[model samples]
Target: MANLNLTQNGNFSSLAPIIPAAGDDNGRSTLIFLGTGCSSAVPNAMCLIQPSDPPCAVCSQSLFVPPEKNPNYRCNTSLLIDYCQSDANRSYILIDVGKTFREQVLRWFTLYKIPRVDSIVLTHEHADAVLGLDDIRAVQPFSPSNDIDPTPIYLTEFAMESLAVKFPYLVQKKLKEGQEVRRVAQLEWKIIEGNHEKSFVASGLKFVPLPVIHGEDYICLGFLFGEKCRVAYISDVSRFPASIEYVISKDGVGQVDLLILDTLYKTGSHNVHLCLPQTLEALKRIRPKQALLIGMTHQFDHHKDNEFLAEWSKREGIQVQLAHDGLRVPIDL
Candidate 1:
């Protein structure tokens, strides 16, 4: 999301109608939901339920409408954090470059006129999270400064190792003798040890990585952005570590301006994702001023999920809602 006002465009306008005011003299940051679906995304290829099935109506409807028009028609989960440093320069930091990265980038360029991404941060090394790294070459030409400097990618050492094995060309620094140079994405890797106490700065923003359990063997990171507008985003997690709970607490109460969490389905725990009950429990612990749920599966119907969450939020007196693709939230930084 950019500071400029987002007007009604295609189908996204119908999903998120309230666009925040732009042009505040104070620094501003916007969190744009590039995609909000889980690994398989909405209308999963294997799930071709008929109209009689539970989520068939929503899934079928999403199939006909293009992603540009319907926020419910999701790709893979990813987010864009845009910081307006000044009226002249805007920097974009992307979280996760999933299989839909190219499509997401093209859509943003058409919708927000985003020239380039300043950096990237990976939550883990899951295929759905890092499969789109090769698409960065398409974005390279749009660099605002047009400098040859490689774009920085921040991740844990394990993630870096996984990337090295999968995309050796992009991570390699030298070309073999007699090997002709070809256009490819150039990236500089920054290893993050996932120490919650240690905060790191990138692209003029401070971030703390909260290490949490993804499953029995994997460790996923939930990021806490420390600035004027505090935001914590945990897109994929099965459980929160005790240290993360302490960090998000203020005195005795939870504190955060906006919390983006993982909610894979309405109920029942998955091996590597949080269920609705788990998400609700985390919400109670985090107690953010506003909360949005992501990593949804085809089981969730956009209209039904929102309607249910809206009523639940009202009853619980919390500003919790289901996030859709293309949703944008502005923060004063």
Candidate 2:
């Protein structure tokens, strides 16, 4: 029943009765935040090169401090779902390998000792989401000599089409009969139907897709996963269709233990991503036990805004806050 039974010095607090204690270890898993910034990334390069008068306070602080030390320093929006099997095995299912994916892997994955990526799910074909598909090779091979099976990547057909034009080799491997497989990433693209809310299995775990509007006519997917505990994730989006809203609501089809959604700015609306006002509204409507806002830009001052969100959480009776890179929340499956 707990949304977050967490770590990293209690950044995650339990909202609903603590998952009936540790005795019930049925579907245990850990949700790790690989990165939590928007496409440009926190401390935008332009902000660093072309300075503002006083300089953006948040961007200013992002420098000279590692993201581990400062939550303000973000790479890209990504989450790693580490599912522990009842048989003592574990699988790593990564969501959205963005442009900063390499940086995230070197930073958090190394620190967390994430051995390998078993599967990958792309939110969309945006550069920030799928450009790092090439870098998957560095983490895939268990041995340097032999060629392994291509890692399964689940994505929408539109995204797959985009990748076909952008990264053709990754989709259809151009290997000669005797050629080696050590150059690029070995990948198998699996299309996820975006027209309807369908449940797909990645690594022995079921994931229900929640489709929402990205820009105007384009649709991006959010996912609903978990057995013992339900979790909903919508990383990049502007608005949800009526069907999406109801599907995620408690009275609709199901409920969420943890809701991870997108928020790009502190106040105004964005053409592609959700702003704070709309994010809060969605939280109110979806009514998850707890929520974490992701895909933030420099306009968001982590410490300052988190303080405000803390108060908002208190008043609204929902434990929602800004999710930072390196955030690890242990959750029930």
Model 1 per-residue lDDT tens digits across residues 1-333? 111112354222221212234333245567788989998888676556444545466567666887677757788899998877656366889999999888888886568777788899999999889999999888786443334778899999999999999999888888799976767787999998888887777787788998988996889998998566677899999987777877775433357767789999887889889988899887777676667789998778777777787777767655677788887666655
- Candidate 1: lDDT over CA atoms? 0.77
Return the TM-score for each candidate structure: 0.88, 0.91
lDDT score, candidate 2: 0.82
* Predictions in order: lDDT: 0.77, 0.82
Q: After superposing candidate 2, which stretches have Cα over 4 Å from the reference?
A: 1-27, 142-146, 174-182
**C-alpha positional error of residue 291 in candidate 2 after TM-score superposition, expressed in Å:** 0.3
Write candidate 2's Cα lDDT for 1-333 as tens digits. Answer: 333333444246554543333323355678889989988898888888898998877888867775678888888889999999778589999999889999899988887789999989888888888888889988977555436788899998888889999987677656678866656788888888874457789987788888889998788988888888888899989988998888778767776767899999888888988999999988888887778889999888877787888788877777788888887776768
Query: Candidate 1: minimum summed lDDT over ten consecutive residues — where?
Result: 10-19
User: Quick one: how many clashes does candidate 1 have?
Assistant: 1
lDDT of 2 at 159: 88
